[model samples]
Target: MPEPIKVLVTGAAGQIAYSLLYSVAKGDVFGKDQPIILVLLDITPMMEVLKGVVMELQDCALPLVQEMIPTDKIEEAFKDIDAALLVGAMPRRDGMERKDLLAANVKIFQEQGKALDHYAKKTVKVVVVGNPANTNAFICSKFAPSIPKENFSALTRLDQNRAQAQIAGRLNVPNNAVKNCIIWGNHSSTQFPDVSHATVTKNGVVQPVAEAVKDDHWLNNEFIKTVQNRGAAVIKARKLSSAMSAAKAICDHMRDWWFGTHEGEWVSMAVPSDGSYEIEQDLMYSFPVNIKNGKYTIVQGLKIDDNAREKMNVTMKELKEEREMALAACQE
Candidate 1:
């Protein structure tokens, strides 16, 4: 038998975790034959529900080995893990501004970051799924001075996936053919899904959609709105939060990081900055990326139009503001 890959999933009791844990265990994301050791990390209060999930996994008899661990100590949960899905955070409540929310999440990720520094494997690739994910990733990466900043990223694959699905429906093509769609900037309303570069391949014909739908002004405006606000749309229709798809996004984030990006396509992830496209160094904003050798590399050199550039600059500023605000709080 080969060495088993150890995957640590935080927020194991989350709605997203419900789909995530079972899917990974049943080999839907990772290979069916690949042996895995799953460490489910959650707060101690969630022990009972976590135990129930573990029992279900046991019944499935997956090729993977699963373990349940309810703990508030992130250091203990992440030690020696190959991949850590840093999910679950304090969701915003009424009357809370984005700055307030960012400050709250910074504290949690700060502790987790310190834990990762002290205990996680040197090669650990972390994906932050919590709200304000890019900023949360910033705290973790900055705190873990030993880890390469590039090893840390936030979940934007869901945005990419969502963009692809929406494009497929509008263009009437199978999702497999929609290649190279990119979501740039914060995973919020400010995010830009640049379908301007998308290509749809079907029936032995490859269609360039950036031009095909360029004239559909209504669609151009509506598609962007739909892609950006799809989260709210789901919540409105379902009358609950988005747990299943969010969980799926976490899986996609990890799966691509470990396995591979498509030959000609890359997904979006918020990664530590090297000042690309004038993004401030270390902002942890989302960029198009290709993963290799257990790491993610930003796909630089893509042309950024004025509109795209302006949108990204706004989100970058938002991240920097959040960072500075957090820093000020730390000082106080």
Candidate 2:
């Protein structure tokens, strides 16, 4: 048997991890043929909880999970890992400001980024899932100078999933019918869930989203707002942030990233920008991307009409401000 690859999950005791660990162990993210070692890490105070989580995994007797290591030490967690799911970050309190939340997470990601640089494999793939994920991912990539920028990404798959689901519900088609939904810029409220290039298939006939929806006013307004605020809606309904759906989205993200996207389709990932679509350079901005052989290239040359351009600009401005705030936080 080939040696098992090590996959690290930070914030292993959190709610999202609670759901995520199971799917990963069942061979949902990586292929079923590959064996994996699960390295679970959380803060010192969460050690007991993490231990229980680890114990549960052991009880499952999953064949793909060759070994499980639960740790509170960052150095131990990072060492020689093949991939990292960076899910930990300080959460925003009820009365706290956005900058304060960014400052708190900056310290966490910077430390983890340095650990990734010093300990993780050079080819490690990282996807940051914490709150303010785009900015946090940018901070992480900055601290890990040696790792290629393409090695890192922020989780915008959840937003993309939300957008696709909304469009499907509107058109009375299955969610899988929606294709090429693009989420532009940050993971925050300013994100532009664009359907300009999206298409939906119903009864085996593919039609552009605008044509199928046939209500530009609703598509331009309600649809976008619903996707942007879906997180809040989930929170309000459950009295907790999304866990099951978030975990599933994370799995979808890593799975597609490892294997490649299908032909003629693209997904949203917040990766370091190289001025694609005139977005600011080096800011972790979300764009439609296609992956091949474990590398991602931004989908280029799509025409951005006036409405799409305006929406993109709003998200771009927010991401720029976020990058500024995240950099300032790094200095502290």
Candidate 3:
């Protein structure tokens, strides 16, 4: 058997983490044969609730879970972790402005990032799953200067998964038949889900997604809007933010990244910009990425039309404003 890996999860008592921890224990994120030591962390006030979570995990008796550590200490949680799922953050409540939410969450991630830098293994893989994820990831990564920027990513797979499902449903094909769907820019409503290069397989044959849909109007307007506001739509229906789906998307994102994507397939990940597609430096922007040999390379040479460019710019502008707000607050 391979050596057990240590995985750290923040917000361990919260809705998303409640869904996520059980999944990880069941080897949903990692493989079945792999063993894991789960280190769960939350704020001190939540420790009692987190203890109940740990008890339930124990009751499940999952074989892959070798051990469980529940803590309110960030340093203890991050110690020697191989993977860190930074899911804990202040949620945007009713009447809360976006800038206010960003400011609040940035402080949380800033401290956690420093703790990871001080405690986590240098090779640790970090995914920021909290709100304002792109900028939260940016702030976290900035403090972890020792860790390579490429090792950091924000969650955009939820958007990508939403796009794939929408396209597959529209084309009357299985979800697996859709490939190369990309979610670009922020994880917010401004995100652009582009299927320009996507393909749908039918009866042992493949065609471009755009050809299958055959309606630019729907793709540009309704499909885009639906995927962009999916979280809000879920909240409207269920009276809660997306927890189960978001957790599942987090699993998919980490699994694809850890195992590698199949050739000719790409997924969206929010990584620091290296000036790809003329995006400014130091921003965490989502882009089409291919993973192989446990490394992600941004897919190159995709054509962006004027409309797509305009939408991408809108999201990018939001990220910039968020970054500015966060940086100013951090300086205060």
Candidate 4:
């Protein structure tokens, strides 16, 4: 067999990593034929827990993973790795400010980003699954100067999927019928799930974007409010945290990027800006993207109606302000 692909997951001891490492081994993200060399990294104490997880992965005998490594050294763990999953972070407690969370996580991602610049494989694509993930991803990419800015993304696919499922349920069709749903801006509550561009269908007929069969107006303000707040609902229901679904988002984000987007179908991801759709550079805000030839390019020239533009603008503003705050903190 050809050499396995080297994939790295920081914070292998965390709950999201708990689910993600197994999925990677079983070919959930990478293809089954593509064997993976799983490089697991965490703080020193988590190595023991990560080791137990690795032992189970070994027994499963997946064609996807050839080996697993549990390490604490950022430089060594990321060395020449194919893809990096960043799930380890300083999570926000109930009373903490977002800036405080970002400040703490920024320090962690910065060191790793430098290590990635020095040691990660030339083509490593990073997905940040941590809290304040968008800003953390921005900090990580900023530290790694040589890598293509497009190679870094934060997880917003979960919000996208959540919106799609909500629409599908409302329309009484399978989730597959929902297309072109978007989560623009930060992965936090500020995300805007716009279905304005979607073609929702049921049975054999296509319908407009609406919450009800009678009313074709789901891309309206109320639905936008609902989709953006769905994260809080999940937290309330689970009464703990959003780990499993977050892991699923990490899986879906990479899977769609690696596999081509469905023909003419675009999804939401927090790709870096090249001034696409008026988003500034390096802010890590979510945008509508279609993957072609293993690269994600923002879908261009879509008619941005007034509501869409307003939503995009608000999210972009939050990202821009966050970027400024981060730069100031970096100087401190």
Q: Each candidate's root-mean-square deviation in Å?
A: 2.0, 1.1, 1.1, 1.8
**For candidate 3, which ten residues in a row score worst on lDDT?**
91-100
lDDT for each residue of candidate 3 in 1-332, tens digit (9 for 90 to 100): 79999999999999999989988899988899999999999999999999999999999999999999999988799999999998999876544567777978988988988998999999999999998899999999998999999999999999999999999899888999999999999998889999898899977789998888899999989999999989878877877778998999999999988899998889999999999888888799999999987789999999999988898899999999999888887787
lDDT of each: 0.79, 0.91, 0.91, 0.82
- Which window of ten consecutive residues has the lowest lDDT sum in model 2? 90-99
lDDT of 2 at 307: 81
Model 1, which residues run further than 4 Å from truth?
Answer: 66-72, 92-97, 214-216, 330-332
> Candidate 2, residue 211: CA error in Å?
0.6
> Which digits, one per residue and each the tens of the lDDT, describe model 1 over residues 147-264?
8888899988888889998888876788887888888788777787787777887677877776544555644577788888877677677765577888888878787887888777
Q: Tell me which of candidates 3 and 4 scores higher on TM-score.
A: 3
Clashes of 3: 0
- lDDT tens digits, residue span 219-307, model 4: 47556777787766666776545778888888889988888798878989998888877777768988889998779988888778887
Off by over 4 Å in 4: 211-219
Pairs that collide in candidate 2 are none
Error of 1 at 39 (Å): 1.3
Error of 2 at 128 (Å): 0.2
What's model 2's lDDT at 281? 90
